[model samples]
Target: MVGRKILDDKHGGKKHLYALNVQYARSEFLKRDDQVLAIRLQQEERLNARKKAAVDIDRARAQAGQDGEPYAEPDPDLDEDVPMDDIAGDNFGSKTIVIHVGSQNLRLGLATDALPKTVPMVIAKKAQRSEADDSEPRPKRIKLDDHAPSEEWFGDEFAKEYIAMAQDFKVSRRANKRRVLPNSRELVTKWNSTTPPETIPEHSDPLRIDWTELPANEKAAPDYIVGAAALRIPERSRPRYHLYWPVRHGWLNEKDYAGRNMLERDFFLILEDSIKHELGLTHRREWSQYSCVFVIPDLYEKVMVGMVLQEFLRDFGFQRVCFIQESLAATFGAGFGIACIVDIGAQKTSISCVEDGMIMEESRINMKYGGYDVTETFVKMMLFDRFHYADFNLMRRHDFLLAEELKGGFTTMSDENISVQMYDFHLRAHGQNTRKYTFKIYDEGVLAPMGYFRPAIFDHSDKLSGRHHLIPRSTDLYNGHPNDPLSKAQMAVISYVNQAIPSAVTAPSAQPVRPLATPVAPTPTKNRPLGIPSHLNGDNDPTPRSSPAASPPPDDGGTPHPTGDDLNGDEIGELKGAQPDTEIIDRTVPVMPLEQAILTSIHHASGMDERKRRDLLGSIMLIGGASKTPYLGQYLEMKLRAALPQYPKEILVAPPPRELDPAVLVWKGGSVFGKLRMTNDSWISPLEYDRLGSRILHYKCIWHW
Candidate 1:
């Protein structure tokens, strides 16, 4: 007896043979015929349809004067047998979930309909125009996966491609369109007989398929679920919980402090306080365990993320949380793509490059330098140079705290000129003579280092050549004349040029000159001897024109001017003769020379070698609250040009908060990374996680490349 096996004809009809068990059938059926029954059945209904299609094809071919070949019948053995159990179960229409996790934040979205809403689709990723254009001052770099697509995987197109690939493999789906079936089941059977059977065919009705064990490519659709475990839990199992609070610095929380402004205190302290407060105020005796995954796939970003989140969570009611770095999460997020995440924050800087988002520990680069450094340098320069009128001593006295105030107030030239009023006064200190000092009483651009990172008064001026007086005098006196602009700008340009040059020679120490007898100078007019100019001039003077008579300085350093007779040659002494050459070279004028050592430092600091350049490029990220300093980007651009002379690609900087607060970029980056949807389909489950635990935790880092 044939088991529950199915058969079909190429014409379209299908038949399922359900034979009784031999033992059971013996008692039920009296007549037993051991034979292949040739029961006459109607030709497939699809034959009519096929005939119509054939007729149409013939008419078209005849109209085009082209003959058509006869169709061949398909082999019956090609019909595949599917286990009955494999062909049954489940509904297609269901709610879909969209989840996003980043290093800094986590967001979940749901879509009942086929399309996801705007909120779920928008992921936070920012790239700066300046970095792309190669306009940044310091062009640092990071190495990225060579095979990673240059274009990002974003938007509907990215999802569409995945869907198309899924469809090609014939996993049942109604992608962007609905799938239709004919009224007759015979047509389907006939079609199934001819078409190759898929383990899971595209046309299998939802009622006949299991949702679990779907291919990832097909499962990636919006309608598919993640872990489906989330769906099993009752909606009332957990209540909606929201805890929103400002985060503080981790350092502050670690070292407790008593201050009037609690918000300004350590972040950890705030989190701690919040948790304590929650315990005191809330009715619940316990809460869910707070297991945090620190996505520090990059050392710097990890440290930063750890610090910030630790502080932020301290205030929460939840305790006993686990922390996993975001870098690892990113690995799970991207599936197979390698990536580099350069996290630039207000106080910290981190660069993590991963072969697959999970950074290999050996490859991370975390540096102390960040946006704050850039701001500090610019703020000091502003207070000391332009605003202070080159009085660096006074500027030096201004502390970082005070300088921040000035920077916040006086950012632009107009702001400095209009708002800042410096008063010059003499003050006595410690019974010493009173000293004169200038104080900036008011200014707006005087902000902390955070403010100068992006846009600022002075963009990228390599310490205006020290040769130029710290500040141009005319800078303080801007006349309405058009020449004033030209003159002042010219002075600034010259100052820059002179400052850049190195001073090779120093002036000789002052020395007393010996007195000599009053000497007569040779006269010019072709009468003086060729060597007369050298003979007549004093040793100290570079220019010694031959004329009539001029006397060397007396013992008291007194000298006399020369006349025409002194410039004349010896023939002139005879009363009349041709003048000898009396040309004098001016040695008093001096040009500054280049400082090789400092220039070398600048070049070296810039990405010089290809490996180092690539390394630097890989790590280059805009950071710090102060990165907004005007033209800071240009300064970095100039430096990169000097540093990485070989690489043609421009260094890219992450865009800051001009559109939004750039300071939050790292945070946003982390938040987005943390929220990545990593299900059992893409990542190892807790059980398998244990299997790979040793390999991951004790993962050996390859240092060589």
Candidate 2:
């Protein structure tokens, strides 16, 4: 955006003046000037002399073989056998692959397949051991709460211990401060939690491996354990590897050890392995036969999308690629014209308003906490009562997995609460003895899930010490503050400017300096296009200083006469100028309450017509893993009805049509979208990507993203 503005100020105020685009403007003005059109038409005369003289000899006949025209030399410029006019690019619908990349899972299969295979979006890399046996710095590791015994207890301390169960992700939920009925909000008044989840439980031999039973051959761990297999690895073997969750909590998971650059590498590795082993596309050549439809989040980074496109079409050998937003695809899957989609993934939750087939950009949000939080809360609640399996440590893979299984099997949100019940389970480890144990759970099963409605129970940050510094908030291309590191584009500009900093520091040179090679701000004029300071742009209008005479547009060979204000001029210098920042759009900046989020999304229906707001409000669909929780939709409906009292008699929470599973609804929508005839024009082949760059998404993606 910054570079485009800089070029516009240097040229005529319009992008229509660019050498590549000027011809279209020229053609439009052709009719206005009949003389020019006539001259242009006349100039299109035959290049070769009309009808060669007889003296030329039988040159044409001599060149031609016995076969007329010598077989036309096979027409070297002919296109590939693939149909260029068809929108699906080089592949057909049956060969098309639909990949739904979720925070916790990766789903991929052919569009024609009945179901997509779900793989965990996690990997465990072999760790390099050191001589000293220093502990690997897991900034995510849990530590005892800092609150002293004499000091008054804090809910954040309880929340801290609760979140420590799934230490990989940091939960920062923003509860709505919206006005509610008297005493409606759930609050922890007296630190009623009998046991604060502060200190890590005393581990049974640090990990409870029972290593005596393992054989020698099984001791050697592989280089990597990926997907579901990674989580199910021997509990004792986990400490030897460093876990990496690529797309954690719906954003690229940034790790201090791998650094930011390796994010794409990890992402590519996860997908690459999943495709290689899970789909049985072992050879890269096989990928060429399939086209891919990639599902991206409603709120996504442009760079992330670019990375995915590059991986699929450029690196992975896919013939073509297309991106569809999760919310938009959900509607397609459900056959809904307009609805609010709340996707509650494992570690992240997103809500968006989709109308027809497009997701409204302003109405989309991605929150950090999700169904996984409920799992953690459930574990914390269980620990409060005197219970067995007290050695539970989430840092261990077995314990973490058990917690997830517990959440899925027991946690519920129904109003009819069941009394404490007895339960039994067998804990099995690879090459180890299986142990059976029995435990009784009280209302914790139901109360823990209710934590989603009560943020005070487990969504605290201020008192949860080391959360920010330990597990720092993940950064991407956005979050444009100086504290955040510069991206490749920003770093390139700085490096270019640094080259001339030495010259500027020395005496004024007799030699002229070029643009970024010399650090200098060419004083901008208010009247110049794009020259007004951002702060003053609203008050001050930009007017081009001069309009030069129009020149001939670029020819088919792409040659053009430079405009007067082009960089070819004698004076052209620039220091690091202000880059355009998309700070105004608050994307998951706060983890808004579910009801408030729904209300806000309904109110901010800029994409849909005003008349459709009512239908959009009533026909809300809650999908994703968390949405499957019993009574969640009911509770959400209750909250929404309270907030939107004026809406119809009830706030309808529609389930997927024909009993379709809510969790897989988005993937099914993508499959349906893949089968559409109109979607043919939306796939981007690698050739188009090379020519148009990441900007191709603007033309190809169905949604505004």
lDDT of 1 at 46: 29
Where's the lowest-lDDT run of ten residues in candidate 2? 537-546
User: Which stretches in model 2 have alpha-carbon errors above 4 Å?
Assistant: 1-91, 129-221, 429-437, 459-589, 606-610, 648-650
Where does model 1 exceed 4 Å of error? Answer: 1-268, 274-286, 289-291, 295-297, 300-344, 369-620, 654-660, 677-705
**Model 2: per-residue Cα lDDT over 1-705, one tens digit each:** 111222455556745332344445456553543344223322232111112212222454565754467533222211222222232133355777788987778888777667788998878766653211233221121442434321112234554543453221111111333222222111221222232232223353245444322235545656777787767655445345566777756666652234555667777888888888877888888889888888887766555676688778888888878888888889888888888888888777777887766766556666556887677667656544433444555556666777777888887765354444567665645554455556666456766766555443554231122112212322322222212212221221112222322211122224332221222333443442222112111111111111112111222122111111121112221122332121211111234456655655554453234456667767888898778887888878877777666664646876787888887888988887776532255777777678766656655666543
Evaluated with lDDT, which candidate comes out highest? 2
Model 1, backbone clash pairs (residues 3+ apart or across chains), number: 128
RMSD values, in order shown: 38.9, 16.0
Candidates' C-alpha lDDT: 0.28, 0.54
